[model samples]
Target: MVKVILFDLDGTLLPMDTDAFINTYLSKLAPSVAEIVDPDRFVKALLTGTEAMIRSKDREKTNEQVFEEAFLPLIELKKEAIWPALDHFYDNVFPTFSYLSKPSPLSRKIVEEAGNQGYRLAVATNPLFPRTAIHHRLQWADVADIPFDLVTVYEESTYTKPHAEYYMEICSRLDVRPEDCIMVGNDIQEDMVASEIGMKTFLVEGYVIDRGEPHYRIDDRGTLEALFRKLQRKEGIFAEK
Candidate 1:
């Protein structure tokens, strides 16, 4: 039986052109930090920090720590000197980028239905952003008020998506086997990697990031929503699987 349902935020739940969203996000973020550091250098540092977070394998340190360690040195600034600006940017400027994303009513319905069926819900978004930034995006998806069993954020997660360890970490936290979890996302490369550790996966198609060939067969969100309805009726894919 599936005990957990993990959903990806960006392209999956929050309808968005990922590249366009990032471009707008960084463009806004650059100006916010321009007073402390040059805009170009700050953007480079931010990307470097994100890369560090993505490559993080150290279970001892959080992704936030890894990002800070790599990011601060590049700009020759201390965390004490830069954190307030980042905090302000996320609190003030980040929400303005909500215009770049469209809320999916289906996403909310899926989450609500899953909750009603007693399935644990998790926002398994990539942990490159702080919790505040993630929370704001969740609000845009209309799932901010829906209680999530777990939400991956830089302060709590060490590994990023596309890494099997990332999925394993979530399973460990929830005290469930990977086989008992289902990951739903738009990126074939990142979300489908959950299958590497034995989690079932569903790929949402509209904003798909298709790579070579997926390791597991992919199912669309429509099929998944139908499956949810069937599960509610105690029939269909859930019963068969």
Candidate 2:
């Protein structure tokens, strides 16, 4: 009954050396907020805020609210002082790092094929960044022009990936059951963990990150080209019996 297909960004939809992009992102981000905090403290505060989001069980508060509660304190500034820097970073700096991500040449085509087959689609990237940042990455993947039923942005999302609630929230919002979705991504832990909530898992190739741990169940594994062909068929992926 797979009514929706959840695609992870960073590695799944937007092919990228995640480590390089993240490191570069960290580097660029530090400079943006240098006036508010030292590079070391800013990174620490940022990671601490991210950790807060991951550890949070509160579904009522958005990740941004949770992040600010933990982050703005460390900088000794209010949201007004810090938001400008972040806004400039995402608007100006973030887009320039497309070099870090490998081109997702098949991204738009794959989504188009999936849509053609009557399946709902979403960009289920981890809800760490604001919508502005996520939207920019969507452009990098060449799928910004395509509409999705859901795009998990930190401003609205209460949880991040790997949490059962995170996947559950999506199903609840989309008005579908967990079993009615396929969570597709390249990460071993963050992406595949969607299977823990009864959603099917598809591990995209060439950007695997299993972390040497016991892996979760993956219903399928292959390149996006392979996925595209699957969509072109009448049976479709996760066809009804």
Worst 10-residue lDDT window for candidate 1 reads: 219-228
The local distance difference test score of each candidate is: 0.85, 0.87
Query: Model 2 off-target regions past 4 Å?
Result: 234-236
Q: Any idea what lDDT model 2 has?
A: 0.87
For residues 76-165, write the lDDT of model 1, one tens digit per residue: 998889899999989998988899997868778878887988889999999989999999999999999999999999999989977889
Structural similarity to truth (TM-score) of each candidate = 0.93, 0.95
Question: Where does candidate 1 stray beyond 4 Å?
Answer: 213-216, 219-237
Candidate 1 displacement at residue 22 in angstroms: 0.4
TM-score of 1: 0.93
